[model samples]
Target: MRTEGDTWDIVSSVGMTALFVAAIRAAETKQPDALVHDEFAALFVAAAGDPDTNRLIDDPELWADSPLGLGFMGLRSKFFDDHFRAATEAGVRQAVILAAGLDARAYRLDWPQGMVVYEIDQPKVLEFKGQVLADAHATPTADRREVAVDLRDNWPAALIEEGFDPARPTVWSAEGLLPYLPGAAQDALFARIDQLSAPGSSLATDTFGSDVDFQQLADFQTEQMRDTSFGKIDIADLLYTDDRSDPAEWLTKQGWTTKAAPPEELAARYDRPLTEVLEPYAQMFNGMKYLTAVKPS
Candidate 1:
């Protein structure tokens, strides 16, 4: 029996690719075209292409008719891109993208020599991506490793089975995955990561802010999500713990020094004028949280 989270994860696996396509469009808007990711975005999309995934793009619908969705995803992408590059520069050599749904970073960034990227996702999703790249003859920039496992399962064991090094530092991301997991699962998820991560590991995630009425947000995305093969999976209770006490701060008390940036600040960072479109998100969702926590030396 597939759970609600399982349903939503697959949907996000399909839906999240829109951000890359939006990034490409944003690049075109730049004077000389400010492109941050590699050309592999298009290639990956083609390789992973399916009717359900392609429908949203072909429909000519932007995430928000305004700029909130596009702006949010864009700013967040560039921010993590910087943090990831910085981690590599600071000597962190391993990256594991959790819920690795449709992200093309393996073929995008110019990783230093010997950098390894292990992407973890559902078996079906993982198989699709691996096959796509192979079929397209796309070479990855980093030493690409794929760990096929459900995030809610004993994935740490699966990752260890895949030869993940416990002694090495790793950069990890939970981008857009928390929404489907139950709150208890969210708490336990990081504990598992803590057990595996060594000193100097870095993590980035977006959390639901205190102000956002998740129930309402769920109602908003329900229609849009329902129209696709991958429909909405509601787990409103799964959002980050409230109290303005961030998930990052929680990790900090656990020996990780954390830094958090609100969505407005992120929008400013990316030069996206999102006042009108972002008002709802800004007032709600406490402005869509982006947080990074690093294990201290």
Candidate 2:
């Protein structure tokens, strides 16, 4: 369940989803034909001390049973990785990752000189990531800064206080984030981004497909996880499935040129079919869309 003033660390509530993502990334890293590689992923999972997630990572059969496993996360990571690369390659040096949970892009990507990457998440989430990476003696390829604040709060002010510049062109990513926010908050989030974005800024995000039956999907997934080592706590409780604006349509109305890639396009482009998802879930997953938008200079 969610509330207006709720807060959580990496091990509970919405935060545990980050650990799950990291575990998937760790699994993806081990694949011979992996789409994206993040060496720090396994380190985060190992440090978390979650025996069940560790089992999921280690046991091939268990990983195979996951609804969204290595193949899906690999393609998802590749899509966002390409987004960042293209943005930076086009000379946008400033980047902000919204709700950046256990994403090691700062450490793994070969960023250009003078690149600054801002990761915004909860204080404890950031703290856990920082401590884990620090203990592993990992170094980021870019100038990395952590803005420890919840996206549901006044994160724009916090980000600006941490040296974000609204005047400069910025590239922002909201991967696996929108579903966790209420419909109204989702709109407000992008509105805040629009206000802060300079002309020519770019944004990338993922959203539920038009054909999704949110309640049904949530119920199905919750039932599947009920007997898992995760206990009664499931991420379904944290997700918001209310009606919301299409990010591409909404951004276009706000003066951005938007491009959307459906799941088939992404699958074909990457040659990475989501082989792990069950048939029913895969049909649902097929409707998921990845979108990119750019404000005209």
Candidate 3:
């Protein structure tokens, strides 16, 4: 649980979730025909220097027990990878990754020349990621910029001050972010994005279903996390879990052409099926969609 004074860095609750995802990505990377490959992910885990995290990364059996969860992460990573590739190929040079935590896309992806990738997150999160990549002597494929600010703050101003050009087309992503924000904040985020985006700009995001009994699942997951090797961090504590509007439908009404798909469909397209054990978790993700929307030129 996060206290009011709890400042987040890479190892905290919400921030540590990034490391958890990276651990899964690292595990997937070892497999043949891996959907996504993050070369720097393993390095970040080792750099964390925590015994529990090290155990989670080292023990493949932990991920093997939840094949559906593992597959979902891989599919999600691939989906975002495809999104960025298409965006860059379409000549959208400016890209922003919201809450970019332990994401090595800038370092691993083969971005084109003259592309600028901006990563937005809290100051400590970005600072820690930079330090880890620096220690490993890794280099990004694009001109990467870091915008250190909280999403609840006047982040648009901070982003613009850090060289974001609102007049040009941009590709924006909000992966693993919305559920943590209050409902009103989520709406405000989209409003801000719409204001900053020029015609031809595109956005990609992942959202949870609004109909699920979130409190029930949050309680269940909280108990599960306590007994697991992942430690005592109840992720429920970090999430706002308020009812959020469907981003795809909302974006369409805002004049952007949008497409959405459930995780099952995306997993099948990648030749990875969700396992039976994941059904309970999937229910919580009911109506959960990976969405992409584009403003008309």
Candidate 4:
């Protein structure tokens, strides 16, 4: 059964954070040519029903010129674009997106031939998303698979039973899922992935945003959660057991050779022009470090 906390997790997470990714993609597509799949953003929003899931979706003015928001989104897009590209180039035919929510990459991105993408999330979430996509008549570009299961459950066993290949290199992305899981659960989750993944497997995920002083977001979100009938669930309470100084450092303990990159460097690599100097607040939070780790082959 899905708890109110779980549902609120979906509510608070959608728009405020996505503003960055969506806007960057929106701006990029306006160019004569762009990188990766520009259309993925629209399909993702249509499938997710931005307003239906995210409370702030109706208020467009909240993030006018939001550098912090865009920075975060830009980071995510660049990370995913790099990881997925590497997965295909490395001959990885299997990919898994945990707590897939309303992500539309399965329908938008051009996956390598024979690649199968499995998305795992709740039944209702997946059901609503499939219905929305069907209504939109959106066509998927990859060999798409949807597995409706709570991340805390025996999803690894279920996935293996469903024919997930342990021998082949798999591209695994955790994205926004970690914030919703308890710390112990997060540990177990990584352990399961490690057990299931073979050498040469790559993992990419966003760590906690520095700005989330989580207490403030918790106080404000608590009131909003209660008002929405989602209850007074503290996000910080339900997830994140190990807060690390370096996400890459922690992964190294798991036998992954890791590299951490700050946002400023990433912008340069993507050829995005640097405008104003970054605000201390924005650079500290949301403008987090991203880490990529690979299991030894």
Point to the candidate with the largest lDDT: 2
Where does the lowest 10-residue lDDT sum fall in candidate 4?
A: 52-61
How well is each residue in 42-84 modelled by candidate 4, as lDDT tens digits?
5545444444323322332343334422444545666776887
Stretches > 4 Å off in candidate 4:
1-40, 43-61, 65-71, 209-212, 217-247, 273-280, 283-287
Q: RMSD in Å for candidate 1, one decimal?
A: 4.1
What's the distance in Å from true for residue 192, model 2? 1.0
Model 3 clashes, total count: 0
Model 2 lowest lDDT segment of ten: 224-233
Q: Which pairs of residues have clashing backbones in candidate 4?
A: 181-239, 183-241, 211-285
Give lDDT for model 3: 0.82
Q: After superposition, how far is residue 242 of candidate 2 from its true place, in Å?
A: 2.3
Candidate 1 vs candidate 3, TM-score winner: 3
**TM-score-best of 2 and 4:** 2
Any idea what lDDT model 1 has?
0.66
Give the per-residue lDDT digits (tens) of candidate 1, residues 32-88: 324254454445444544454445444435344434345455576677788789899
Better of 2 and 3 by TM-score: 2
lDDT of 3 by residue, 49-154 (tens): 7666666556766546453245778898999999999999999999999999999999999999999999999899999899999998888999999999988778
Instruction: Rank the candidate models, highest lDDT first.
Output: 2, 3, 1, 4
Highest TM-score against the true fold, candidate: 2
Note the Cα lDDT for every prediction shown. 0.66, 0.85, 0.82, 0.63
